[model samples]
Target: MIDPAILEPLADDAWPARERKRLGGWRLNASSGYSMRINACWPLAAPDRDVEAAIDAVEAWYAARGLPPRFKLTDGVLAPADLAGQLAARGYREGKDTLVMVGATDGEGDPLVRLSFSADETFETVFTASAGDPEDGRERIEALGRMPPPACFARLDVDGAPAAIGVAALGGGFAGVFGMRTVPAHRRKGLARRVLLTLLSEARRQGVERAWLQVEADNAPAIALYAAEGFQPAYCYRYWSR
Candidate 1:
């Protein structure tokens, strides 16, 4: 069983923020508010100061940067135990709930899937077209560009057009899948499954032992797809924001 404690940091490194700071064990990440994970503070453990003071400092930090303060709290792993209560008392509302799923890396890769060290034009096209918010797509594309070496950007083309895209961020013997998208016209064709298999196959080749991906809790179709591929839920996290 992969520990959520260990996987959380790997996830952070996989999807890095533009600017990062530390309030003791808490991680303060800011990235233009495109994604909650990149814009929120992750309290993996207790802070150096009291919880209330630490919350004040976090708000101040984000305020200095002209962004709202947010927190990513994982169930069963909340540091200081009462952190959630404190956030609620402070008027922080619970936001998007996400599930972290884990699976083995061993798999047969698809030769038709195009792999690149960076997000190519096709990948960006598919991602941006599929995203509900253009700004979110742009920010994610930028994040993809920031992925360190040994990362893989997987794309599958159908009828000479980009249909599906996914990303694998490799580090610390783990591979994290992000930016999984299928063009609306291409949905239900199992393109996502093929993309996932390709990613896991490459991860295995690169010596990654485990694979992880995050999906919104309300996305039943995606959850079913991942579950069919042997991915099991390891933990759930939600953002706390005003």
Candidate 2:
């Protein structure tokens, strides 16, 4: 039940590139290359029908759209007992191990952090500075272009330029936080912490009591930072790519 429940914010925080469709009890999403969650099959329920055919349908759908076939499956109660085996039989390999961290939204905001309602130049610049290229920043902005209501982007300027940036979306009593990035030269500084605390404060202002974010399992610095901010791992998920 936690799996289905956790999906509430994820589904609510839809992007512009999202082309979501239902396959029996599964949600097949193809968002081009925007975000992995929107481009992977969310196998939520155990199908009573043709499971293999359903899997084939999903693969065919992604192939027709020229998307890499991917499945985002969580551990324990969130994943089907036989899902891993089924995917293995299909030549699917695991990719991008991630952890879903949860925390409270009672932290105080920092005056240095500035929040915006939409993707502006400052936000783009901070992203470009951290993402290492303009194409990655543009792709993210393209996805954020269709972000739903009650979303906010946070930026922290250093030496009159944006050094830290993050984004959050409030939905279903949870604030979905992601894309927290800091410029290379600005790393090891406390700008990211300020931005995080500020974003948590904003989430509280938006009436959200809980905060959630996904980070790659191998990201030690980020995991340590979030843990220090009172965030704890709720579940783990990995992409199975065919």
Candidate 3:
């Protein structure tokens, strides 16, 4: 289990967009009118002590900014047994439950996966084809406007066509894999797997010892695929929104 203290530092390093503030011994993070990824909110006092004041302050902070207060408690947190119910009473509900899967580079098998990465027309085609909504996709790309080059874009083309696309960032000795998508026409043809494997291979090549990614809890097929590739769930988290 990872220590809760690790969260404050990690959150600052990995998720810099959110503002970090320590109130009444609990750390509450918010991004103006945007979003907040609660890093840690453990009671500085005893478990039996009242945390109402702290909770109220956090709510007020969000209310003042007209931003929704959100929290994500991973399975590794020690205070969930004590804090979850209290949070629920305050109107915080579990949102998307996600699996935090990790893969180690040292473990076995063919390090070379038959996948090609190229920057061409196929790249843009894959990105456009896999997007369920053009506006949303464009918005996401814009949100990542600060990400550095090289790690920002990559696409896997299969048989002269765009099959899958992936975006990643390197942080804390881990590659934060995000925006992995496969075109609808390429689904179930092992395209997604091949692309992901290629991504992992690239991460290893970049000296990343571990790779971490999140998948919605209900995404069974994706979970199965990761599990088969030796990725294990290190923890789980659910987003909470009003």
Candidate 4:
């Protein structure tokens, strides 16, 4: 079983300041208010008799901020007796399920067929060419460029045209795989898989032993690819929006 402690560093690494901290081992991450990735509660510590008090504190914190209380519980956390039922009783409706896929970098399946990583210009070109909105793409590119160079990005180019983009952030003995996107025209050409492999390679180069990523449960294709790449569902979590 994967230990919940593995997620401790996410508070400062992945989560942004807009994410609000709350009492009772709960956090109200408002950074991406409407996005499942941002708005959720993570029980960093094991629940005990004080679990109710912790829930109350979180609810109060949200109420004080004029935001509805939202909570997310993963398979790693659900083993706590009645945790889900407790949240449901307090009007927290379940949202879509997501899988926490994890893998180690010691062994790789296959080398990416045609993928490479370069500086800002190359990443910008791929992001701009693939995103639906050119302006939004530029903003994303700029944001990613500001990140430390250790944050590796890989682009899959097909016939000299940018087809997919992948990014990984290294920290705290782990590499987080995120920001994966493929151009609509290049769907199902194995571009996503190639990009993922490239990210893993980058992670391995960074001396990161473990890699982790999250994907919606309904995204069967993505889940299948991760599974084929030796990733296992270490846990599952769901978001609730009021």
Candidate 1 runs further than 4 Å off: none
Q: How would the candidate models be sorted by lDDT, starting from the highest?
A: 1, 2, 4, 3
Candidate 3: worst 10 consecutive residues by lDDT?
38-47
Q: Which RMSD does model 1 reach against the true structure?
A: 1.1
As a whole number from 0 to 100, the lDDT of residue 106 in candidate 1 is: 68
Q: Please give the CA lDDT of all the candidate structures.
A: 0.89, 0.78, 0.58, 0.66
User: How good is model 4 by TM-score?
Assistant: 0.75
Candidate 4: global Cα-lDDT?
0.66
At residue 28, candidate 2 shows an lDDT of 78
- Reference-based TM-score, model 2: 0.91
Q: What tens digits encode model 4's per-residue C-alpha lDDT throughout 1-242?
A: 46655653352355343545645345555442334444456665554438787777767766776667777766555334577787778776788897778888644424543434434576677666665677555545544554444677777777887778777777777777777888789998887887788778767876888888888989999999889888998777776555
* Full candidate order by TM-score, most accurate first: 1, 2, 4, 3
**What lDDT would candidate 1 get against the real structure?**
0.89
Candidate 3 lDDT over residue span 71-179, tens digit each: 5566655543566788877777777777777776433322333333333455555555455577544434443443433353456566766667775566667666666
Best by lDDT: 1
Instruction: Indicate the TM-score of model 1.
Output: 0.96
Q: Candidate 2 residues 132-215, lDDT tens each?
A: 666655666667777787888999989988888998877777788877988888999988999999989998987888888888
> For model 3, what is the alpha-carbon lDDT of residue 162?
65
Clashing pairs in 2: none
TM-score list, all predictions: 0.96, 0.91, 0.71, 0.75
